[model samples]
Target chain A: MSNEVEETNSLKLVTPGHASSETEGRSVDAGPGDADCSPDGRVPYMMSQIQETLQTLDTAVDTILGKVEELHSKYEREGLAENPVLDACREITFACCFHDLCSQRLNIVLKSLEEFGDELTDGSNGTREEASILASVGESETRSATQDVQGGGSLLNGPAMTGEGLSQEDVDELLKSFEEFN
Target chain B: MAVDKNMPVLIVDDYSSMLRIIRNLLFELGFKNITEATDGREALKKLNRDAYGLIISDWNMEPMSGYDLLVAVRKDEQMKKTPFIMVTAESKVENVVAAREAGVDNYIIKPFNGATLKQKMKRVIGDF
Candidate 1:
């Protein structure tokens, strides 16, 4: 039941004053990308696969990290040396976070190149504006900027964040820079 | 040995996150020109299209893994000279020996940091 409410809220974030009824049948809401989505709002087959794979990988990382956290909590009172393992975990988290956001954005560029092969046949003339236009992909946060992900928020669950799309952490960070980006 | 920081480098891995992490480490070490491929087949495609100073690839992937890629690259006269570095989680001595026999220039174990990557890069393409 809570999933329904969370999903509904995710639909609400598509655009200010946009009608939720207009977005009813879409299985996923990709934030800004909704504006450009097909009427049925399905993601491209390849992009959906990529998003699914990335989400699985992110979940795997989260699972491992969670285990480490649990270990840390379990061992803290044992008086064993803890800094070495904790420090390594910190570094691993940093690397994982950086990799997650940076690669998702890079995949966007690669997908654009694949989809619009004719426009970029020459490869040299693709402009920043063209990239931005394509970046406004009609999917929920297929990815966020490195700036948005630095906080270790659980943004991978989907554009519907915590349970659905944007988590509170993700939404707050995104809102801080929303006006600047738009 | 000395190396050119600006030389084009090709990195291959099915996991985009692994690619991103390696690319960032290379970037930090002053190497800027980088291309990425998800499997050995795609890496070969890029190898055919352009010259790379080095190739760093993971060992496991669908349709093509880094070992097959290394053998193919070694067989190709044009790409045989390009330094190849294999990256993977496998630490078994036999795996390292297998990569070496296949003509890999170096090997990197997974969960590596910038220093380890830089050290591997030094062994293959020389110090940056």
Candidate 2:
């Protein structure tokens, strides 16, 4: 009976090995799980992801710009600048401006994200201080976002300026309005 | 009143791509003398510095919007006579009304082709 009791105690001690093995299995599944466990690592990883996306977008914009430039030069050299083909190309080129506009807006988003990430990883201060810092960051981000939307000091609003083409009625109205102004 | 194709035109937009696009379109239209500004402030500075025959500007910009630029241009004694075309994506009646009220010579919506631009230009500045 005493031998049996000793054997059960040995099994109980070995049971922790199973738990440790299970933990190891989980860790393996996580694959660099430390990043997931630590805010510092995770935030940076997220930032890198955003940077990679921005790089891809930048590459796409560059490619479009190159292709359009090539097309423009070809047309110019051929003296086909007045042709409908050139007209279509011009439209394509204008459409490509979307890339630059998107890039600017994305940069704003990236900046805000980075600031938030920094706040999340900042562990040097107490909770209260961190909260205050975060609040300030939030305020600044809000201001910038508002400025971006408002077009700041620029004369143009954002995408709102890119709405559908005006109608004949709209044109007539504009002309009539112009007459009133004059 | 025929538009002088030789007249110096100012193209304004915040995006370099937009500026380039507009510049190319203008080039195709036989407008040889062209000036470029990235924003309304720069456009205003250029307007003050040189006598632009026409101003084609995007409606949305930072620091100064196209509408604001038009207002400023209209208020200025020297620049008020300059034919101003507001290029925008806004088809809203209110916006058009506001632009007209601001004394814009013409308006062009986005995704417009060269022919459309030419027609608008002709309307504003007469046959170019």
Instruction: Give each model a TM-score.
Output: 0.47, 0.64
Over A52-141, each residue of candidate 1 has an lDDT whose tens digit, in order, gives 666777777667656755665455546554567655644664467434444445465556645454333323367755655654563335
Candidate 2 C-alpha lDDT tens digits along A1-182: 11111122123222111222322222222211332436555556556656766777767766776787788789889987587866667667777766655665566667767776666656445574776677677756644221343343322233443444466456766677667776
Predicted model with the maximum TM-score: 2
Q: Tell me how many residue pairs clash in candidate 2.
A: 19
Where is model 1 chain A poorest over a 10-residue stretch in terms of lDDT? A153-162
> Which candidate comes out best when scored by lDDT?
2
List per-model TM-scores for chain B.
0.96, 0.95
* Model 1: colliding residue pairs: A30-A139, A30-A140, A33-A137, A33-A138, A159-A165, A160-A164, A160-A165, A161-A164, A161-A165, A161-A166
Candidate 1: segments with Cα more than 4 A from true spot: A1-56, A59-182
Evaluate every candidate with DockQ and list the scores.
Answer: 0.04, 0.26
Residue A85 of model 2 has an lDDT of 69
CAPRI docking class of candidate 2: acceptable
